[model samples]
Target chain A: MFTNPQYGIFVLISATLLTSVVALLVAVPLGLMAAIFLSEYASRQVRGWLKPILEILAGVPTVVFGYFALLAVTPILRLFVPGLQTFNGLSAGLILGFAILPTIASLSEDAIYAVPQSLRQGAYALGATKRETITNVVLRAGLSGIVASIILGVARAVGETMIVTLAAGQNPTLTLDPRVPIATMTAFMVQVSGGDVAVGTIKYKSLFAVGMTLFLITLVLNIFSFWFVRRFQEKYE
Target chain B: MQTNSPAVGTGTAFYVDNTDYYYGSFQAVRDVTLDIPERKITAFIGPSGCGKSTVLRCFNRLNDLIPSAHIKGRITYRGVDIYDKGVDPIDLRRNIGMVFQKPNPFPKSIYENIAFGARINGYKGDMDELVERSLRAAAIWDEVKDKLKESGLSISGGQQQRLCIARAIAIEPQVLLMDEPCSALDPISTRSVEELMQELKERYTIIIVTHNMQQATRVSDMTAFFNAEPTEKGGKQGYLVEYAPTQTIFNSPQMEATQDYVSGRFG
Candidate 1:
């Protein structure tokens, strides 16, 4: 249906990339801080109670998250950015970040907590503060795990469907501003599939092409993360 | 408190008086009284589960890491009660360093590993010289000096232990507490570590825990022997059986149990 392959592909790819990048910017720092609190600072009783709450957030269906973002979060965004639309990439991404919080936070906690207790003791015995130990020794030691956690979170954000489909609003013109409407590849596929496109048409075939492209991107990310984890093990073990 | 008791002496590096430690409701050690002298190597020798390590950890308050682990009675370091409410464990630990049974190095470059503690303690001195001097003091400098930028885990197990000792000493702590510093190494590494301890005692007070009776006798200036008795409900409770000069503890122990343990008749 399109004369140029790069014409549709570039804009769609950038839209997908932009949405995930915006989401991760919000996710990584907040997720890492929460992971640090869960692993290092929380007492056993507090951890037991707090962790399941995070899991419940993770367990919430993405379609529900899409609805929440479309209805609730966009209004809040509109209050701050006057140019924000009813359906905007910024709101979709921010809410998607919260949707993936438990994935990043819980996995990062596992990484941080997997650092040997002896390392913590060594830091403590040197008269290092708790912050020093966590940042220098524990976090540094668990670097691979933490990076892997982030990469996995990236993969999740890239592959997420319902939030982008509903809230991002399928208008895939590539602008860097997140307050504008955008169409993720996932959202565009949903848009076309939900409508009446004939089976043999290029519009219908473009769905498979887009699906293949997203699959390739996510596959590369997963492979890279696994490779990183293996490299970490080879060094530490 | 017998007349010939070594505890009678005024060796004031640490004065642990009636120090009882508990893990939750279970008392692990009872009525531990000893004085670790300054600039000397003190060894704690006992069988497994005798709480020798628990007692050694009290010297630097390392046992505080355990949530349910609590202690009663007095432990003084240079006239300050380490367990006092006013004492900050962080400041206390800076003055007292530790080497674990297994070498525990930060997963950083050897240079960074040695420099980390000093940096966090706000060391304003030339770090290169300090890292060199600390590694030299630990006797692993000549071996590791060429690869300063390599990860600490890149070294051999024995060299890693010495690096850990270097990291601990780089902080300029006054006392060094080692929990089985050589239990994980080969005979050659163990001997070198023992040699390092001999050299280190001139600079810092060293307290070590070991299950090896020979290791205790060989390296320590004074030795404290611990023995355990099973409580009524099938748990072991450890207590100090004797404290004496290394020579006396090895050659002629005062208590029957100490004699029995050193003679290898029973643990």
Candidate 2:
């Protein structure tokens, strides 16, 4: 399988997408809620303390996060689930979500904060409650920025190598079940690069093929983000 | 300063008495007392930093949005103290709406901009009919009727201001507080808005704060002249100099300050 370039490429691609989906599930809600709280509800003193702490999460080394996922998160999950593997997609993807959480939260907070104060005032003068104002006015105005942050998070999750390689293992399997071990495109690239493969061989060349595929995916995401922002951005004077 | 005037006449919508507004102990306005008559245009004219806008905001408790802003004395709407503990500012704002100096339409379709307020206030009637009625009332229906689905921000500045006014009135508030609503508009737009105010006064009590004294004389039935004096702390403290019928305010003001202000002597 190490020499056969096409043996498990389908499984690797599927694992990459599945894990990214799981990561988005963990990141989007928590990150968006944190952003809204920071931008809207939190006092200046609390925000001063909290925003930096959340950003510090983004600065932690990914290798350390990988080990933490493998050693700590997987062990905890094993206790809850009936059959959880030591090297599984769930724990790896969950940790990946945390890895990208700050990316979404910080960017989304800036977007929500940038919405003009007059819009909120307009909503309030119309008898809208704070919740209604936030959902209808603030969120809608910040939609383009929020969507951009989520796309960046998805890109981060898709391209992340160390965490998946270390925790989700190097076993490529064509399955969506996260309780078992899986391999992502990035993990395969890492494996091929780290092992003793000849420069001219198919296995070594497969790395570039996978790298190109990853690049294309992110390029598509970026183009979509550009289009989406142009389509939905609320211009304020 | 004469706080009350005989020329102000009958039906009172807002009774503001000895109201002192403070932003964290720095007095912004003091001893502002006036009766805003029902279904009439009452304009507040003052120089910059005289707190005409501040007094206007207090009508709907819009100042409550500022963390450090607090008021002393009473502001009553239709006989109820708006600042009372049981009175919800949300409900109070519903009964009394506002239009800002700058036109701020929601970055939504023009239709949604009007519908949003009505929807949030639990308007259970035919939304389309309500939208049309509000737009027609604001006198922007003919210009924007065909492009209802277009972004509210895509319209002209004057049209956007009218849309905002339509948005405010969609929920059917009894009083509309306008803070320099025409300051950001062109002369034509200002004239149209002034005309709209004349029409709107038949149904809703209207209070407008304007730097343009001519506007006050032109649109208001009653006028309040506010003056600012330098305090010991070097900050300006605004107080009402006089309240009278627009005719008296412009032609026969009693106070020298009001006379000088109306005659373009000084702010």
Candidate 3:
């Protein structure tokens, strides 16, 4: 039932920081590309097929994604990296990335579609190709929404538990290597919840402290996303 | 063929030879033929859905964009067939700009909106000068110069229409086609746009479609009247009724429909 208060607090803070950064770094680019594919490249028929498939990926239990990360993804990484750890942050981050793809894609698509059709026609009438029109007009016009989607994806990644618990290891080492099995805040919460700490002790209080840190991190991301979207939504009429 | 008029005042800019337009088996315009003089304002006046806009769209082949629409017959630009197989619609549209009835400006800065055509054509010259010159020509420069970086939608309806005019003129087209350009403007804005059209005809060949007979009489030197012939299926089919000098058409129109319309008897 004993817990070192200083080490517990430090572990909680570092894990929260690492998880937030890893989530954000993976989500932004994947989300932007998803938005583009869904809004611009996909035909109506393709969209009808692809959108539901993407949402299903989001709806799938995170534990299943974690299981796939452990059995399928980590093994594949080992073949390439040779010394890759069984439960590493990279696999957990990748699964987390996939889990949040629909969030980013759907929100960003809504933003892009919200841009007035007149602006798009105006661009095309000026002889802009589809690529130029999407990049210069559609994407730029919808950039705020895309940014908001990425932040929401980060929030989803930060709050994730079962996937990180299964894929990311329990060692709270503050290392940046993707090949090493690194612990995240959500993983620690799940690890400690499994009878390793008694119900009414400082060790249990540590869980809420970590939960508070996770909540604060996601809250900041959500606020920053709101600010970013508000700042850019001023362009379109 | 007849005694050639002074070269300064007589050259064909647009020549329509037996042109026909159809919307998927529904004929919108019949075998119509006419000549529009260079640096002249030619107005097409007609009742609602009388193929005036269809003919105007034919100048730039905007009709081709509609999947169900088809065109047969030759439209010539100074002697070259505009509908030739090798003609790129984009290039043709660049040379033949168009403004719609409703104001349609890019949701960008006034400067970028004017510079859009120039940029698309890869004009890397001093964009500031080109933007200013085009806006000045469209008669919107004095009003929008201070707010060059502001969004185009922020402008009033009149200014937005003029901004569209400036956007069209920025490409430095040989001709400007207006499909009811003043239909959405106020009286004062309409007057300003009409005056701008008059000044522009000295440089750009202008074709305008209007339902307003007075607009046709006021701004155009040449007027083409179109009438909707009643069909069996409870709809009207459009055909060209007459084409002549505006004064001649208003004073002594040969077609009964033209006289009826000008006299405000019926559209």
Candidate 4:
């Protein structure tokens, strides 16, 4: 199936990587900011209410987010972009970011909160404002955790099938423009699995190959995430 | 008016008057009044849970960080009410720095740890010179001169505490509030830091909280003893028992609790 594909499996892999990168480009900053808010700026009452809402967002079915993107997000994008497609990677990537927001925000917030209160007091004692303390001391101390959270979010974005399959279209065209439809790795796998193709054929075996590639990518990401968390867990004692 | 405390000299660095602290609904300390003389080391000696640390924290507004904790009354630094409406706590803390009971250097390089405060304060001076001067003052420069770029946590317990001190001093604070600075160190490290405190007192007003009475007598020019009373609601409230010159508190009779504590009778 690798040889039989229109542009081979590279197109699918690249599409998956591009979509996930775009998703993470949006998710990381928003997630990190939300985390900083929860850990530093938010009062206890606000955090108590805000954290569970993010957790609930994480728990929402990806298919539901995909539906929201299709019926709610794409039309809005079309109004601005003039000729945007009904099913485009832009909407898919955007929705996937929100889908993964809770994963990124909750973990990052926990890490930042775990930064020893002493480091914060030390910074504040030196006349640093809340902003300065969070940026220089809390965020710097929680860097490993924040980076690990983003990478894990990236991995989640890559493996996410229903959202991209339903919202990002099913054509495996290799292009950088997010305005057009593109088939990601997971979307292609879903397309094949939802087919009437017979077992023991190259199409079925090619699914395994794609699955293996996705596994390897996520495995590498998880390994790096693990190393970062273990190696740079900041100790302020 | 003739209480053992001398009249508020021009040397007074902090005047904590009738201050009571609370954590949510529970009162921690009551009616704490004292004058911290400039360029002198004042020690707070007390039993556990006596809120000595709480009172010490008030000098720099560190207790303000705790959401539920509140202070009622006045803490003036150099004749200005620091707790007044226009005063910013951040600005107040700049002139009044703190060192925690345990060593807490930033997880940065030793050089960076010392430079952090000065940099954040927008000091445009030669950073290397300032780092060296601060470390020298803390008495850890010679030990850490070779590994200035190493992480501050890589050092020994005593050295880390000194790094914290150097970090505090790099900001050039007028007062240094050390809450049990040597409680986490070995005897050797403790002695080194105690001596450093003596040298530091010549430049900065030093207020220290110590569980060790000997450490207080050895380093402090003035002493304040605190004690806690058990409340009926299964809580404890702390109060200041006596404040005087270190020699007078140790030798003279004023409060029975002070007499018992220094004489090895009771806490």
Candidate 5:
């Protein structure tokens, strides 16, 4: 089958943008909640146990997440959202969110912990309650760290490929609706490679264009995360 | 030879009675009792681990934050029991501010450092005037006035300690606790802090803990000597060995331990 060159470029652009938007939407709330839970809610013993468990979540292979998304989450969603497609962005995005939750939680915990003990004591000595101390002192002190973690989570989501390819349907429609099936740039690469496109063809050349766009997107995200962490380098001695 | 003139009449400021401090199973300060006078500087001088700092922390209940630390006994401020269940530790600290041994300034602008305690205590009027007044009172306003916007950490070691003093007094505490406030400073800076202390004593009762015997003799009107007492169970605890006017404590100490310790005979 002859693949149209124009169709390939359009699919690449549509997929990249769709993936980025979905990843960002999922990363923000999940990551922020994870950070708060780990840093503020968890007890020292619970934190000792839960943090490593979260890291295991982050360490789980993308292929395992893809399998979970395809085999597990889709079936669950089918019960409520009737007519939901077998492979959809929602399942993949949710699983990818779980995968990156640890990045947000661990880094944010480090940031919150980095707040000086003296400052916390100072706040408490001023008659501030536990909630007040956490809100006014700990969170304020750790703002830069939290911002850096969110950027890192976003970067991880944007760059993820395996889960998106297996779970997200290879339909390149440029719509914001998570309920509808959509293809991401990573899925397109897998689709193109699965078929027999002759060497040096425009079809083959289209992958390079998609590859370049993905590279730039991930590079920009990486740079952003780096700068954010550097900006808030802990100054307490 | 800074003015040895006793500016304020000797009136009771603090009445720390039968106080005991425990760190888990071990007692750090044992059955201590003493009086601090209003508008005067009282120095606690002792060898290392003699609970001078520990007792100092008790005045403001700063030890409460340490999970293992426990206190029993009465520390009265203006004749009110500080350890009373209704006495808020925060309010107690606000009325009795502290300066640590090492200079610790917030990682903020110099102006904000002085304003932090006041803001926390809900000071709502004349923030600029209050900040300037506190700085001038601490005697660092002239050196740092133009650079109020600069980071507090950017100042010299001596200047940072004074900034801490300003930070403490911004809340207008009735008493100031100094835990070796000059130990980390040079002679020049130490002299400046000593001068500031003398000036501050006119308005606030000052309790200073110093490892330097000369510093205690130079700045305090009264001096308390703490010594380690070995327990039957084989651990050491700290208690007041002697308390007297600085002149008597230094020139004519009543206790052999105080004389031995002060005369460089023993720790």
Candidate 6:
């Protein structure tokens, strides 16, 4: 459909949605558990050393992660799964999830830590086990912040370009199949902006249009985050 | 020094023998030996830094939550060593409940606050009835029965403290440790809590830590006064100065320090 631009644009949008969905599936549970471990279980010395190391994953260049996905993850995935392509959304989305993991984990850790110590004491006084206190009290109190972090992670996954472009290949297909090659909206923009398309042409113009679409998606998520926090956040004095 | 007054006829509930509390290397309170009587309101009265609250927390093993805090001696509840290797603080806390200086209700609704303790302790009874019974016993049922779904924080501070009390009692604990429970309340609220103590002592043993000497005299059957002296490192070390029936401590004390403190002549 690259020869037919209209159909290709639709394919690019679907690829973006599919990849982001995959990324969130990988991130949410892993990130949240990591946050809880860091906040509730880790000693001060362990947290002091471990938190910065986890954040360092966020600072690593996306280009490096792109290559690591292409060269490292895809080959390993190919050994287990049948019909897996060298450039597939599975590998790209998995790495994209890792790339944004620290955002969710770090922010969520901060939120869980921010829950007042009195609440924990109150739960303990009631004979709540550590797991019960965390799940019943701490998680409920920190829900708004935890959700906000996930939304921010979603924005990062949606806008992520280098990993999908380098690892997911330049094929715009209207499919949710992770094992197949796909090109996200960001990947399409990268393709058009490489000086291959002439100025003022349809392909070049589509870059700005796709950029606006990405902006709107993230803007909607952020606005929803604000509304959600206001609506559901537990008020504590 | 230990005091087992003859006026304590109900039998001993907690036996604290030569206990020394420490935060890491620094000793906070030393050699605190006392017998707290069952089904009675025992007050620990002292100035700030005297470790009254610290000793109260030790009863429920709530002080175990602090990483560096440790105790050197024995604290037994009904002849069971609470700090024994086999003892789980979680289970011990079910038998012994605590209320803080600040009224700390969960951010959940009023009904949820009362129900949470019961639920966690595996209460299979009707939750609605349990909530009502607990709130009624705490004397806040009339004020809060209408707004059971409202957040616990939505109420006034006095009502919130009562709600916390209701939450604590919902699990039907055998003992209740109150650490300056009325310190954050107004005079009226304090009076109400003091009265509640009078009623609660019929069923459960109570130990309170308070700065108000009058509160000790008004509510407690027995009183233990703690005094703190500065160490060489400039941190205060708390020790039990006197323990006896509240009447004797206030009217005919054994120690000069107890006399000075009860008369407001010394801290």
| TM-scores for every predicted model | 0.95, 0.97, 0.86, 0.95, 0.86, 0.95
Fnat for every candidate: 0.92, 0.80, 0.22, 0.80, 0.22, 0.75
List the candidate 4 regions with Cα displacement exceeding 4 Å: A1-6, B1-10
Runs in model 1 lying further than 4 Å from the true structure: A1-6, A234-237, B1-11
Clashes per candidate, residues 3 or more apart or on different chains = 0, 0, 0, 0, 0, 0
List the candidate 2 regions with Cα displacement exceeding 4 Å: A3-5, B1-10
Cα distance off (Å), candidate 1, residue B33: 1.2
Q: How large an RMSD does model 2 have? A: 3.2
Q: What is the DockQ of candidate 3?
A: 0.33
| Chain A TM-score, prediction 2 | 0.97
Error of 6 at B30 (Å): 0.9
lDDT of 1 by residue, A1-237 (tens): 244545677677888888898889889999999999999999989999999998899999999999999999998889999899988889899988998888999999998988888889999999988888888888888889999999999999999999998998888777877888888899888888998999998888899999999999989999999998887752544
lDDT of each: 0.88, 0.92, 0.81, 0.89, 0.81, 0.91
Question: Measured by TM-score, how close is model 1 to the native structure?
Answer: 0.95
- Cα RMSD of predicted structure 3: 4.2
What DockQ values do the models have? 0.78, 0.87, 0.33, 0.79, 0.36, 0.76
Model 1's i-RMS, to one decimal, reads 1.4
Model 6 clash pairs? none
Candidate 5 lDDT for residue B23: 98
Candidate 3 segments exceeding 4 Å error: A1-5, A8-43, A196-200, A234-237, B1-10, B23-28, B63-65, B228-237
Write one digit per residue (lDDT tens) for candidate 2, span B1-267.
012434332568889999999999899999988988988999999889999999999899989999999999998776778899978999989988899999999988999999999999899999999999999999999999999999999999999999999999999988899999999999999999999999998889999999998899899999999999999988999999999999999999999999999999997
Top TM-score model: 2
Q: lDDT: which is higher, 3 or 6?
A: 6
Candidate 4 lDDT tens digits, B1-267: 011324333368888999999999899999899988988999999888999999988888888899898888898888788878878888888888899998888888999998889998899999999999999999988999999999888999999999999999998888899999999999999999999998998788899999999999999999999999998898889999999999999999499999999998877
Question: Per-prediction RMSD in angstroms?
Answer: 3.5, 3.2, 4.2, 3.2, 4.9, 3.0
Q: Assess the local accuracy of residue B22 in candidate 4 as a C-alpha lDDT between 0 and 100.
A: 94
Candidate 6 lDDT over A1-237, as tens digits, reads 357756746788889888888888888888999999999999999999999999999999999999999999999999998999999999999999999999999999999999999999999988999999999999988999999999999999999999999999888888999999999999988887875877788877888888998899999999999999998787676
